[model samples]
Structure formats: structure tokens, C-alpha cells
Target: MNFLSPLTEGLRGLGRAVLFLFTILAGIPAALLRPRLILQQIYSVGVLSLIIIVISGSFIGMVLALQGYRTLVNFGAASSLGVLVALSIVRELGPVVTALLFAGRAGSALAAEIGLMKATDQLSGMEMMAVDPIKRVIAPRFIAGLVAMPLLVSIFSLMAIGVAGGHAIGVELLGVDDGSYWSQINQAMHGTDIRDMLIKGTVFGLAISWIAVYQGYHAAPTSEGVSRATTSTVVVSSLAVLALDFVLTAFMFH
Candidate 1:
């Protein structure tokens, strides 16, 4: 029992830390009203994330098509491959997987950069110079992340669909008709599914960027601390995306 006490205590502390971060992020709206920060945030989250999203999305679609076609063919349901590929990529796998990759690539970078700024007191200096750090730093990041994620996800979804289409035409060996494939894709996609994916992407973006900034802001004032904060931001953001996915799925689908 004594040995278990330390583990329990550590868990409690971690929970409290996470809770505190949520409270701070929830309060970010107060800082988001500044115009300068909003533009910067838009650039950081939206513009920067585009390349990675496009590249990853294209490949994911191709891979999904390749794998999904194999499975469907085994069951002699190869004609429905487009429907399954589109739905899985657009509604579920696309947003979640892209977000996870984004978190690993960009989320950690954001955290480390911000953590370094915090450690070096650069953030404090901004405050001293009549800059609201939240407005200047956190607000843009939050807004950028929120705005960029959906756009990136949307781009990813489109590219993935394209790639899947190409793969089906070339590699699936399914002999599926082109018109049939597109018809199935169109039938399977609904306005609601699009809305759901966009919502999920937006929320994921906000959560990931917020986690990175929050971790950076609260990191220990040392280089080692910044490294740890960066790593933690990626891990926590990825887990949060999965957790939120389940919650959103229950609400949207169930």
C-alpha cells in the first residue's frame, strides 16, 4: 500500500496540473479580441500547417485506398470501395489522423518555441513593453490554430479522396467502374458529415495549440524544462484529440 501511495499522489498532481491548464485556456477568449494578435494567429495556425496537411493527407488517402480495396475485394464487395474509403477518411480517420500528425510535427515545435521565450523572460519583456502577452502571444496562436486546422483538414480530406480515387483506378485491381465509384462517394457524403469533420478539426486544432502554448507558458525556466514541455505538449495534445473524438462521436453519431 505504501508503494502505491507515491503513484497515486503523482496521478493526483498530474490531474490538477491538467485542470489548471484547462482553466487558463478557457479564459483565452478575453485575450483574443485584439486585432494584431488575431492576424498573427491566423498565419501561424492556418498558413504554416498547410503543406504538412496536404502531403500527409494525400498519402493517407492512397494508403487507405490500397488497404480498404484489399479488404473489400476479399468479401467480393469491391464495388463499394469508394463509399467506405470516402466515409472512413472524411468522417473519422481523416481528421483524427491528420490532427495527430499535426500535433507531433507542429504542436511540439510551438511548445518548445514558446517555452524558450518564457524561460528567457521574453514574454515578460513583451508585457513590460505594454504588450499583453496573451494578446500578443497566446491569442494569435489560439486563433491561428482554430482557423488553420479546419482548412488543413478540409484540404487533407479532398486530397485523400483524390488519391484514393487514383489508387482505385490503378492499384486496387478491383475493376471498379469510375462512374460507380464517384456515385457511391457522392451518395455516402452528407452535409452533416462534412459539418462534423470540420467541427472536429477545428476543435482539435484549438486543443492542440492551446496545450502547446499553455505548456510553454508554464514550463520551468530552463532549457531542460522547455524540452520537457515540448514533449509533454505533443503527448497530451494527441491523447486529448483521441478523447475528444470519442466524446464528439457519441454526441454526433450516437
Candidate 2:
């Protein structure tokens, strides 16, 4: 019975989380009626995250280019460096890495802010004032996440910082043939690659936002509980991102 208790609790938690997610989803229409809330959350979570995203994307791209150039040069295929970096960043790294970073930065912040609100009885205060916190609070953040992720992935992989960093490293620094670099990238990249990135971004955004909000909403209303929820938000969101990336890749690429 004791061993079964853990499994039972796990299943119960899963059910509650799913219900919480659905409630937020259900509130989205009403939440949308107030576009200012969604816009505010977007600026909070998305705009504030741009610095880290751009800097990290640049560094990740540069590292990919450096390592890829070495391997391709060994194979006398240095011209393929651009394709390798592009595919790697666009197909995998951009979405997954960005999600992880988002989980750490924005997701944890969401959890903490919400958890603290709960701890301080602010959510209760809202309920007393006849305001539904789900529509007023959670849904806006959830929609903002959904809206921001695909755009961030595009900036990271497609036309801006990440690919540009790779180009700088591969072509200018390594002196790889510039024509072949751009030409191979243009030739090898397909619509499917872009589709995969967008899909992954959107799915990851949903999962991360769901977990963050759920954890916070259910956290015990205490300082320690709020801290635990914040930590759980980051840990659980990261693991979920990695696992979902694998599943999405298998399904999408297969």
C-alpha cells in the first residue's frame, strides 16, 4: 500500500496538472478579449529574454561552426560546414536550447512570481474581489509564450544572430569558400527544416508554460513552497524540453 501510494500520488498530480492546463486553455478566449494583458506579458517574458537569446545563439552558432569546420575539413568536405551548422541550429539546437534557456529564465520567473503571489495571498485577494485569476493572470502568460517562441526560433536560426555567427566563424575566420558556404546552405535547407523548427518551438512553449503555471498555482502558500516551485519549474521544464525534443524529432523527421 505504501509503495502504491507514490504511484497513486503521481497519477493524481498528473490529472490535476492536466486539468489545470485545460482550465488555462479554456480561459484563453476571455483572456484574448483583453489584449493589453497578453501584450504586457509578452514584453515581460519575451522582450526581456532577447538579450540572453541573442547572446547564447551567437555563441552556440560560433561553437557549432568551429567544431563542424574541423570535422568537415578532416573529411575534405569543409564546404559542407555551413549546411551542418545551419541544419544543426535550425533543426535542433535553436528550439531545444532556447526552450531550456526560457525554462530557466522566464519559466522560473513565472513560477516564482505566481508562487509568491499565492504565498502572499494576492491570488486569494483576486478571488475575493470576484476576479478569476486563471483568465486574468495565467492565460495571458500562456498565450504570450505561445506567441513568442516561434519568433525567437526564427531569429536564432533563420536570418539573424545564430546563423550569422556561424557564417562569421566558418567563412571569415576559417576562410571556407564563401560561395560554397552560402550556396550549400541555400540548397540543403528545405521547407521541412523550417517547419520542424516552428513546430518544436510552439510545442516547447506550450509545455514549458503549462508546467510553470501549474507548479506555481498548486504550490503550497508558503515561502519555502514558493522556492520549491521555482526550482521545480526549471528542473521539470528542462527535462520536459529534452524529452519532447526527442519525441518531436522522431515523429517529424521519421
Candidate 3:
């Protein structure tokens, strides 16, 4: 009981911190009326994330097709390759993988940048000048992350499908029917899966950006503190993505 108390308290603190940051982000409109911030967010979150998501998505799809084909062949069921690839990539792999990549790329950078600013007392200087740090700094990043994640995930899903389709054509060298491949994929992709992917991407994006900024804002006032905060940001955000994935899966599927 004594040991569990610390864990519970820590979780409670984390929850409160997240809620506070989210509340600030949500209230940005009334505080800061800048259209440029939205454009910046779109560029930072969406445009910058395209290359990584595309490369990762394409390779993952190819690998999945290769692996799935080999496994299904062992059971004399090779014709179902398209269904398996599409279902796995769209329903699960697309959103989760893209989000994890986004977290590692953009999330870490956001944390380090904010942590550095805080360590240098720039944030305090802004506050002394009557600037609202939430409006000027946090809100833009939060909105950018939220908007960019879904766009990146959708691109990833599309690229992955393209890669998988090419891989399927190559698999026909082993006598798999080309006509049956696309048909199986069409059958497997339900409308609900698309909605689930979008929802999961949005949730993951919000979690990653929120955690990154929160860690940066709360970091200790030292170089080592900034480093620790950056590390914590990446680790915590990745774990949160996975945990939320499970929760979403259960809720959406059950």
C-alpha cells in the first residue's frame, strides 16, 4: 500500500499537468488573435513531417506484405495477402507508426526548444513584458501538432498502400492471382476503420505535443535539467501513444 501511494500520486500529478496545458491550448483563440500562428503551426507540424512519414510508411508496408505473404503461404492461403496488408496497415500500423515518428521528430524538438528558452529565462522575460507565454508559444505548437498528425497519417496510409500494391504484384511470381488481390483489399477496408485511424491520429498528436511542451515548461532550471526533460518527453510521449492505442482499440472494436 505504501509503495502504491507514490505511483498513484505521480499519475494524479501527471493528469493534472496535462489537463492544465490542454486547457491553456484550448483557450488560445480569445487570448491571441493571429492567423499567422495557424499558418506556422501547419508548416511546422504538417509540412515538415511529410518526408519521415512517407519513408517509414512505404517500407513498413513492403515489409508487412513480404512477411504476411510468407506466413500465409505456409498455410496455403496466399491469396488473402491484400486483405491482411490493408487491414493491418490502415487499422493499426498507419496511425501508430506515423504518430510515433512524429513524436520522436517534432515532439523532441519542441521540448528541447522550449526547455532551452526556459533555461535562458526568455520565458520569464516575456512574462515580465506582459506577454502571455501560452498564447505566444504553447498554443501555436499544440494546434500545429493536432492538425498535422492526421494529415501525416493519411499520407502515410496512402504511401503504404502503394508500396503494398507493388509488393503484391511481385508476389504474383509465386502464382498468386492478381485479380483476387485488389478485391480482397477492397473487401477488408470498412468505413469505420478509416474513422478510427483519423481519431487515433488526432489523439496521438495531441498527446505528443502536450507532453513535450509540459515537460519543457516544468523542467528544472539547468542544462542537465533541459536534457532530462527532453529525454522524458520522448519516452513519456511514446509510451502514451502506445497506451492510447490500446485504449482506442478496445473502445473502437469492442
Clashing pairs in 2: none
List the lowest-lDDT window of 10 residues for candidate 3.
Answer: 164-173
Using TM-score as the measure, the top candidate is 2
Q: Model 2, 196: alpha-carbon shift in Å?
A: 0.9
Put down candidate 2 lDDT per residue, 66-156, tens digits, no spaces: 9898888989999999899988888999999889989998899999999999989999999999999999999999999889888778777
Among residues 3 or more apart in sequence or in different chains, the pairs in candidate 1 whose N, CA or C atoms overlap within 3 Å are 41-140, 41-144
- Is 1 or 3 the stronger prediction by TM-score? 3
Candidate 1 per-residue C-alpha lDDT over 192-237 given as tens digits, one digit per residue, 9 for 90 to 100 = 9999999999889888987888788889989899999989998999
Q: Number of clashes in every candidate structure?
A: 2, 0, 0
Higher-ranked by lDDT: 2 or 3: 2
Candidate 3 backbone overlaps, count: 0
Ranking by TM-score: 2, 3, 1
Error of 3 at 178 (Å): 4.8
- Segments in model 1 whose C-alpha atoms lie over 4 Å from true places: 1-36, 163-175
lDDT of 3 by residue, 20-123 (tens): 68677676784457868867877876798888988888788778777787899899888888788778888899999998899888898888888999999999
The TM-score of predicted model 3 comes to 0.89
